[model samples]
Target: MKIKNRTLLLPLAAVLCVAALTGCTRTSYAIQTNDARTIISDGKPKEADSGLLEYTDANGVKQQISKTEVKQVTELPK
Candidate 1:
């Protein structure tokens, strides 16, 4: 019983470690709008409660833009 438990624990621990580290990787994104303004986001944008598109800027600041203004969203190069 002890050996079986120990065997399972190693793989379980490894999986948990991998999952923990996975969240550390952040992908930046670029939001192209109808206007000439270029928006760089720290991560994927989300729809806020006010119905505006909310995203974290490259400077770590939170910003919101109207949905109508967004032309396209593309993942930036890593």
Candidate 2:
């Protein structure tokens, strides 16, 4: 009886471990607005499916970064 229980529990434990590892990873992104406002964009923003932040530097060059890949974000004084 104990042997049969162990056999059943082993498979269930493996499935639970796999499910936890493959679960969606949540991330946060800092968006620098056009008006110099900073915001955190987690979900898909209007037009972008990846919830990426868009901004232009002093040179007027556009740049974008996805929320998922952003480990951390910091703002510097202009």
Candidate 3:
């Protein structure tokens, strides 16, 4: 009874510790748009975000990306 509970507790504690240490790792990237202007996250080129780009992934459909998701700020053609 007590031994069984202790055994389960050890494994559960270990799992929780690992999860706390390694949460979700998000990487940010710069994406080029049809427009020459570059948009960056954090309102700066040197800043980073959770993900490189923020896009809506529909069922079996092309990814709908937002212009603001872009992580680069550059000049656009006039």
Q: Write the per-residue lDDT of candidate 2 for residues 1-78, one digit (tens) a residue.
A: 999999999999999998997675434445554555665544333335668756454444556766555454554332
Roughly what TM-score does model 3 have, to 2 decimal places?
A: 0.32
lDDT by residue (tens digit), candidate 1, 1-78: 999999999999999999999989899998999996789999999987776899999899999999889998889888
Per residue, candidate 3 scores C-alpha lDDT tens digits across 19-46 of 9876653333334566664333221233
Comparing 1 and 3 on TM-score, the stronger one: 1
Candidate 2 positional error at 3, Å: 5.1
Best by lDDT: 1
Model 1: lDDT equals 0.92
Model 2 clashing residue pairs (backbone):
none
Please, what is the whole-model Cα lDDT of each candidate in the order they appear?
0.92, 0.57, 0.47
Better of 1 and 3 by lDDT: 1
Superposition-based RMSD of candidate 1 using all C-alpha atoms, in angstroms: 4.5
Show where candidate 2 strays beyond 4 Å. 1-4, 7-21, 48-78
TM-score leaderboard ranking? 1, 2, 3
Better of 2 and 3 by TM-score: 2
